[model samples]
Target: MSVLLEFTIRSDQFKLGHVLSGSGDMRFELERIVPTGGHTMPFVWVSTERDPNEDLPRFEANMRESDSVQELLALDRVDDGGLYRIEWEGQPEGLIKGLAEAEATVLEAFGDRNWTFRVRFMDHERLTNFHNYLTDHDISVHIIRTYTFTEEGARRRDFGLTNEQREALVLALQRGYFDTPSEVTLDELAEELGITKQAISDRIRRGNEKMLRPLLLSSAAR
Candidate 1:
C-alpha cells in the first residue's frame, strides 16, 4: 500500500534551510526537484511579507555562497514573489535527500522558520527505510501523521492547507455554508474566522481543489 507521510524539521540544520534562513521573513516553497547525473536541481518559489525587490538580491547572494549550490538562476517574478532555479552541486540533505534516495515522491513542501514536507512511499518498507536514513544522519524527524493513500485520505492529509484554511473549512461546514440552504454567507464565515471574506474564499477554493484532485483524476479514468 502507498503511504503518505508528513514531517517537520527546523531550518537551521539543513543546507537549503541555511541558504533560506539568511533572509528574514522570506518563505521558500519547493516547486520541483530533478536529479541530474550526480546532482539535483531544485526550483523554488520565494515570497516575503515585505517587498521582493528589497530582499531577492540578498537571498540570491546567500544561495551563491552555499557550497551545495553550484549555480543560482532567477527564474522570474511570480505575482508578488520570485521564482528561482538552483543547480545543486552536491548530494541533498535531510528528508529531501532521503526521499530522493528511496525514489519516493515529495508531493509538497514549504518552509518558514521550519519546513514541512509531504512524501509518498510505495509501501511500508520504503517508509521504514526513510525513517532509518533520517535516524542515521542524526536528523530529528517528527512524524506529523501518516495514512494509506486513498481518495478519502487525501482530503484529511493536510493538502498544503494552512491552519487558517482548515479552521475556515470546518467552520464553514459546521455553519452550513456548503448546504443547499446555506445557513452562512462568506461574510459571516469570514467574520467568525476573523479574516477577510476574500481570504476565506481563496482558502476554501484552493483547499477544495487540492483535496479533490486525486479523486477527480481517478474518476476521470473510469
Candidate 2:
C-alpha cells in the first residue's frame, strides 16, 4: 500500500537563518515523510521569517552544495505556515521523529528560526518501535494531514478508478484498514463499514494484490 507522509520541521535555534525566516515563533514538527520511488518529488524548508531575500542566496548555495542534503525544494509562504513539498528517495528519515533526544533538540530550536520541511515517500510505516518510543516520552503529537500519494493517478483520474472505488480506497487507506507492517485488524473498520471482518479482509487482500500486480508480473517477465 502506498502512503504519503508530510513533515513540518522547525529550524535549529543556533542558526542565523532560523531567526531571519520567522520560523522562530511557532515550533514545527514532523508530520509525515513517505516514499516516492524517486519520481522527482516536491519539498519545502523554510526559516523563521517571510522575506528571506537577504539570506536566501547564501543558504541556497550552501544547501545545493551540501553532500548530506538530497533533493531540496523551496516554497512560497502560505497562511499558517510555510508550504513546500518534495519528492524523495526510499523513505526519508521518518524514524528521527521517534527519538527523544532529537525531538527535544528540534522543539527547542524551533523558536529560534523558521524551519519548514516536507517529504513524500511510499511506505508510511517502518520505523520499528520509533513512533511508540517517542510517545512513551509523553510528547503531544498528532497526524495533521493525509494524502493519497498519487500525483500520477490524480492527473489521469478518468482511467484509474471509478468514483466509488476511489472513495472507498481513500477512506480505507486513511483509516488504516489496509494491511500494514504492524499487524492491522479489520474488526473496527469492518464494524464501521457494516460488513463482516472477513469480507473487509478479502477486499483489502484483493486491493493490495491489484496494486502489486505490475511489479509481481514484471519479476516473472524477467
- Among these predictions, the greatest lDDT belongs to 1
lDDT of 2 by residue, 111-131 (tens): 234333223333445222434
Candidate 2 vs. truth: CA RMSD? 17.2
Query: lDDT (CA) for every model shown?
Result: 0.77, 0.41
Q: Candidate 2 local accuracy as lDDT? A: 0.41
lDDT of 1 by residue, 101-172 (tens): 877887878887799888888998999998889889888757789888784255656666778667878888
> Against the true structure, whose TM-score is highest?
1
List ranges where model 1 is wrong by over 4 Å.
151-160, 165-222
